[model samples]
Target: MARGCLLAGARLVDPAAGRDGAFDVRIAGDRVAEVAPSLDPAGAGVVDCRGLVLAPGFVDLHTHLREPGREDEETVESGSRAAALGGYTAVCAMANSEPVADSGAVVEQVWTLGRAAGLVDVFPVGAITVGLAGRALAELGEMAGSAARVGFFSDDGRCLQDSGLMRRALEYARVFDAIVANHAEDSALAEGWQMNEGEVSSVLGLAGLPAEAEEVIVARDLALARLTGARLHVPHVSTAGTVELIRVAKRRGVRVTAEATPHHLTLTEEAARGYDPVFKVAPPLRAREDVEALRAGLADGTIDCVATDHAPHAPEEKDREWDAAPCGMLGLETALAVLLTELVPGHLALARLVEAMSAAPARARALADHGGPVAAGRPANLVVFDPEALWTVDAAGLASRSRNTPFGGRELRGKVVHTIHDGRFTVRDGRVADGKG
Candidate 1:
């Protein structure tokens, strides 16, 4: 399975290059040696992929593989398997570990674990602040020069609200072209907030987190980014005002990019009516009008990409009452299918889907080896799937250690049949291949 592979008759959709056509892609060793029609197998393992779509391996800018502390919830091994099964070749691991990846040694430990897992390339993100306390800055220079070569930094579970601190971090990151990713919530405004601030929270008798809690921070960060001329990435955009802010920022030449999770695009405040903890996420889902704005933002290229903030929590932790449970959901396994079911045919095209899920994330995170056209000399990280296949999600069947998927038991269309990572099959026939490299 580590040898080269021949993917024949699949429609290649490479949004990065704007190419789409039926082709046979031949991978030799760790590079794409050739791509054309009716190529000779040449002793390679051949896969019949007719009626399937071959695209670049997906890149996730936001993922929480809770290793180094919360192994019972998720580890590098378990989360990498889940990502591979979901057709991802690379994932940016957040620095919110117990010890926090604020230094070279800690970040390298996470990177080494990813290499040992042999499922996906895990790039460790350094912390923007020491211990994510939003007080002092972390060892950005040390991490950037570490073996991990960390290019992204964040205090994702928290925000860098001190305008002076944020300005310094962005100014420092600007030197290396590293991005400062923000979780985008004003802590004081969102204090004790349970869900979206509207009729739903009033009726449910829960404290509301007003939409301004998120919008105000985004607006502030965009202005800071303009001042520093630094690349800023906003994660989990959930409000109409936030989208408009990003739209305006980009229009006015402010360097900013944003991601919308699968749940935000598909769910609404009504899902929280039943007090289901699974629907509770950071920057809680918004009302229908906000959802429509998100969709439009994505469609019109205002929102750059779709990132699975694939946060996993232990059963005991997630099964609690609504207010006590953590705010997140399992997303890597269901993101694409959920988007296909929610946006295709009416709102989005297949090419746009590839762009948002693959190309844009790679560009946003500066992952050079991922999100490319199927061509000679490129890294052979690719995914092949039956775009028309239908399936259902069973939480127990997922590859992650935690069963916290919000889409459990829901029927979904579009199935990933095979995933080729680094010129080999990590997933074949809709199942994981040998995990040991």
Candidate 2:
């Protein structure tokens, strides 16, 4: 479980290296020492990954690690464990904790917690608005310059609805060299909305949140990014219209990037038919057309990367009636399996999946020592998993403190058997391992 380990006979899918073949990857100290057709194990511990896929460790752009408060939902430690088990080596923690990661003090606290956990690299995302009220801006420069050095700012759970405030935030982001990630939901258009506005909502007699709510914000933010010259990131881009907006905006030379959640790419609004609160999520799942569009975007490089949007809510919060339940689902533990099951098999190539899950998101967040090419001089962060392994989801078996996963009881292909972070084994043989101590 230490740095001197060799992974042999695995199909190395390194999109950054543009290679997909059987290669032996060697880890020395904290960097990838060698990668070739054959490597000398010498005195290193060898892991025989004959039928597995070895790729660079993944990076998630959006994750809600409920720390500082609401630890019952998820903490940095628990979320890190879940992410490691799912093959992620770094994750950008969203700024929606109880006290709110609006200040340098709180973000630094979260950053230190991740260091102590010794799992994935947790990037603390500073809040864009004070207390997420959206009217006034938080101390952006202060948070950016603090010990955490937060580079991503967002009010993820709430949208900064004021156009003027949104524009100002973007302008400041340009000055600070940071990203302004929008939740992309227009409050006025989505007021009291329960699910996606479509035939299903009509049949169920439920108030629907029109896809326009998401698209409108995306369109406005694209223009705002263009006008202010700030880097804009759209989180959990739902609906076909929103995807189209991002596609067109990128073509028009807007400095914009977007991410699609696993649920949005795989599941649809049809899951709401049973009135199960587990299916309830903010920016509710859209129709099959939207799901297809999301998959296409990921395939065509229109969508930058796949982020879990790994929101965790307490049992009591999500166990209520559909209308009263909190809108979220656990994701950190199942993201890779879900994507491999849904996106692979002729729809997308293995290299493209590695790009969407690893390289793109890592470069987007500017996380160092991640998104590897599986070669010399790069930090050794990798995942080894059987591409054809099948398993059923079990909530009780998951590593998260909360069990709100909508994927529970679903069978999935692909399973992580080993995860390496910075040349140390955080998970091995489908179990958590600690080499730091």
Candidate 3:
């Protein structure tokens, strides 16, 4: 094998280091050996990165790999491939699987599967509730000490409704400095809801999920986080009210962080107008004003990062009537394109976008080796992309096993040209590398 690789002549955009200029980065082993204005290729394999932006690889704090049970929808290998293709070098796998990743064995299984994939680094999120049952706590300490070393816990598919239980969970997580991410929806208020509660839902005559449903839970969680002083993460912040709550909580010194999804930032409840099941999601799409608030929150630092909820389902499960279909849509492959096409330059600066998608998320998840500043001695976890490249989304061309992307058939800009993880090219020339070269 080549001793190292040389990425030549790329505009390095490392938000963590506040760098945005032309530079050549040399990789030796799995670390960046050098970074300069120019470097000779020597014996290293050279990739011409002219006209591309080389930045730290993206990180997703909320991705559903659906392994150990729902392999028909997605597996660690397939999901890692999709993440690499989308410029991500690391992703936090959600605990909501068929058997539920509530124990050390399960989380380790997921972690091992990710390593075997040899694409992105996968960190398994342990379940906060046993079997996501909401009644009892899972093996948080065990999972944390396990081989996966899970530092994030959540019952993403279901909210832990018992206030006492949630407080106890927060207190327990504080001992390990782990993050407890909540889905932030009250089952009572969002019960049987089909879409966001608004004019569109009123017109469509479908049951509505009110914004207050999310805001109430967030308020409660914020209070609990303040009481326990534990690290709390709110996943997929969707509503304007929730954004305001998070903003105020941060101002009050609560240990809280929030994330917004690409779909939630760009799409609104109006996408459900045609009753397309693909648009159905938990904490369902909110109003246009809510979308604006989410973007502003991300740009202004109230929202910490952008995470692709990246849920995938089988065709039979997602192609049914809106009310009958399951929530979630494919996101791993299209998150960057969607954000670049919809928010960059207009609503957010490119540096801020890079921070949200890469550095910020890695910081939130505490993945020290993933996000970067392209300095010597840093891990070679990086992505190179053409900011001006445009392409049309096609479900068949995606690496995910499901065909449930809402952006299918839509044109998007900023295609990923290459993705490197641990000094190996996982994606090259806009295609997944076979590792043979």
Candidate 4:
């Protein structure tokens, strides 16, 4: 008797394996036992997955768990639950914590917390500089060799503006074959900026963050990356100029990869017309032309993945006046729904969307156990979604501790039905499964 789970009659869509068809999958313990057109349940527990789309679980290249200091905003446990509900089995937690993840000790603490949660695999990103000050490099080698085995490093909330220091960080990261993800913004150019610089900012009398601010830093970092011959990742690419820069860099064979956020891809500066802080984000939203360029970049494979810069701020922090409010919004819960309702079957194909959210990020971060082919020998990391299921976003109903979602009260399609992590149900029937079901 097979003592495991059987998922029957799912439209298995694994872009990495070039598989898209109806099939039955059997999971025994942590590994997939078999996949065929039909299978006898035998003694395994059966889950009827007819008409659902089963694909590799999503992997977010960028995420902010906000622990070690801002636990009131979000903790590893709550964020992992949110990610499980959102169809993500793994997330790269950013380096911006209370004390900052600049040292091996801090990153290992984060990794330990994620393991305790047991819902998702949380990989902590090491900080590029001590205290994220950009004045000197942090212990990259120490963190890489830590128990966390950190392979990604970034100063996400702030850009590494010092060119010499940036180059040094790149050179050091290359030695370990780790990634250096930069928050591309020239701080001086974007100082005191409230929103994207354009018609909307002018009308609202808010200081605008010019698209050039992002482009300038991106251009500088690309040059340094070319020089160091190191892997560089551009996070939350916002402008058309940045997109073109990355496209050309890839053509020139610079070792670089880029990601665009869901908000940047679907929304625009128009969302800020109401002066709502939820719509405010770092690097801010850009114009319609920029949004179009981001979509085209993702569609053409220039942007490697869709990363959720899922920064969470408490209501008190986020509900302030336009200028006093903090940037960022909740993303883990709404990412898939928003992409499916807004981009799929139009701006992006269904297959590409799955690949961008799953395989691409997994490959970028070198997460071997994630972004699966759903084969017999692979780990059972998968998400079953109802592509046509429609639901409304409710702020209070979210899993994260924060209530700052940009998609609040909006109806969206493509709901997650179940998420299997390590062959156990993390999410079942659209809710977090109980006691590792």
Candidate 5:
């Protein structure tokens, strides 16, 4: 529970070092002091990690903890609990909160609440536009100077479509050494679209969200990134063409990174055929071919990271008719399981999974404290998981404040057993610790 060496004995998989073996990891006072075979279990808290896979704690580049303004939906506390249960040690809380994390004061407030929550590290992201209005650039430098150390600026859940505004924002954010994270949807092209436009939408009589809506924005943003010579990160990129665009940009030496959500890699537009809003997400799930392409991208390193995009909504809001309901699904709690069950077995290896979930996001968000080789003196944020454990997802029993999981009742392989955050046992044996640290 406190300062001590913890011998986590499972299949230790530190993808950053390409180390995978049945080893022991020792943590001393919030830092990994040793990681090797058979450390003496003498005077340490030997957490029996039998049948588990010990790895670095996950880092999410995209998460919507709708606090400050929409506590009715979620708060930093509830969302942090969800993150802990999901084996995450840190998450980049999005800027699209109630008052919006545009100014330094609001962003600092969000950081304070996250620290108080004491579950996982919540890095506050600053808004790309004031009030997320897409009109004027937010105070990027002020936010970066705040306690939050804001490194990501976004107009997420909405695109910063005003080309001039976007250019200026990229230029301004560069001054703070921050990146502009775009939602990448053309408002005019994606208006009123509920789910991915395709044969399924036509069959269900639902409005379709054409892939071009996302593709067009991604193309424009890449061009802007090249022009401004500023770093850009495209969040929740769901289409194959978008991945190709990012690949080309990287080849051209544009400082850009892109992330794909678990839903985009596993589920498809076919899931929306039943008119279930749970399957509704921004950049709605695409076709099976798109999912395959994304998996290929992850395997080949074309896609940089796998973010949760963990959006939570209250039951009342999510239970409405498909078109009337808010978009998003509970992902933090189920992302790893979905990956292991849906992707790893056939398409990707466990090492690739760890990289996508941890190192890549850490690099993308510039959180140097996270994602690493389990070496001496590194921060002791780690996760021990039972890769062989199979379980069914229960939305009602989740740690999240809201039950909007689309994978409810779905059987999945692999599960997290113990999550160590900053050397604290936030979750032990698949349960959260009793008190807030």
Candidate 6:
């Protein structure tokens, strides 16, 4: 796609530079050319961002793009479109794809398809263990050398239970400067679980996935990180105890960081009281106290980022009974709105939100061209959002291949109006733009 010009008029928020202002931003050749109170509208395409808030495009640290297999659920093309529509310029596509991205060949294939999609920068996260079985480590070094430049590895939806194997994986990954991300669930304790192990699950007669299931794994991972002096990241940590554990570990200088999902930050397991599969997710949502603690942690800078955990499922897959249904919810489009309406209103600043959504995730994933200060030399990945714009989420209207969003019919306060990836408007006027290339 050829690049030209764009003047995004709204509150420009760039967390990396600590900048916030109502400025007109100009783009030229896939990089931010100038940002000021006013730019010469000389022959440039003018975009009326009257009520929008322009910021660096979001970067999701965790996303499940079920491709290479399970294309019926989601493919790189469809998932990339979903990311673009959700205001993400980049997303770390989980390695649990079809055929499992456990080798260099598979990883490179995913990377190529993602680029061809031309909607988002999809970084392929390599599996921590081959087949994500938690028994043997995958070819981390080889995958890291592939086109994807894999830096993050995870066994998401499965726990790395063997301490020796995990230690070895971490030790080996460090050689290539890769970080190991754990799903943080003790399979032994969480066996037969469906929702959060609490009063809600008990009341609903659903098998409870205990909080200790997460806490124990978190505590163990921190110890391993401390021992190996290797970088570790915990994904979608849902319990308050896990938050305090990470806080203390960071205090003690353990090389550990953690992320919380939007659902965990806002909705509790109580939202699953009706056995709605939309709320079903791995590391199921927890109690209200946990939600408050997660909010406090994000506000206080203990939690490193807020990831979507954007797991997509076909309608038939999620339409089953609670126990028979698959875990996960569509998150890309609803994440920002949930953050704006639920977090910002309670003292979380817009800058903090940007950090959690973009800057931090970029740093965590080690992506060179994303997250942003929006300078003259950086890649022009940006999003124009109408922060005050109110709209109802109609799952039927989303760009993802699936309509499993938990926010269906809910009125959200913020909406993404335009998303530019590599200087091309992948999403314009709140709709997915056809591929420019």
lDDT of each: 0.90, 0.90, 0.93, 0.93, 0.88, 0.87
Ten contiguous residues minimizing lDDT sum, candidate 2: 428-437
Prediction-by-prediction clash tally: 0, 0, 0, 0, 2, 0
Q: Show model 2 residue runs off by greater than 4 Å.
A: 435-437
lDDT of 1 at 272: 89
lDDT of 4 by residue, 56-110 (tens): 9999988999999999999999999999999999999999998999999999999
Q: What is the lDDT of residue 171 in candidate 3?
A: 98
- Estimate the lDDT of model 6: 0.87
Which scores better on lDDT, 1 or 3? 3
Which ranges in model 4 have alpha carbons more than 4 Å from their true place? 1-3, 435-437
| Native-referenced Cα lDDT, model 3 | 0.93
Question: Which residue pairs overlap in candidate 4's backbone?
Answer: none
What lDDT score is found at residue 206 in candidate 2?
83
What is the alpha-carbon lDDT for the whole of candidate 1?
0.90
Instruction: Give the lowest summed-lDDT range of ten residues in model 4.
Output: 1-10
Better candidate by TM-score, 4 or 6: 4
Q: In model 3, which range of ten residues has the least summed lDDT? A: 428-437
Could you estimate the TM-score for every candidate?
0.98, 0.98, 0.98, 0.98, 0.97, 0.97
lDDT of 5 by residue, 1-437 (tens): 57676665678888777788888888889888888888887788788776788888999989999989888778999899999999999999999998999999999999999999988999998998999998888888899998898989998988888989898988988887788888988989977898888898888888888889989988998999999999999889898888888888899999998888988999999888777788888889998888888999889888988999999998898989898899888889899999999887699998889989988888887887788777888998888887778999998898888888999999999888888888888888788884642
User: How does model 2 score by TM-score?
Assistant: 0.98
Count clashing pairs, candidate 3: 0
Residue 250 of model 1 has an lDDT of 99
What does candidate 3's lDDT look like per residue over 295-331, in tens digits? 9999899999999999999999899999899999888
- How far residue 230's Cα lies from its native spot in candidate 4, in Å, is 0.9
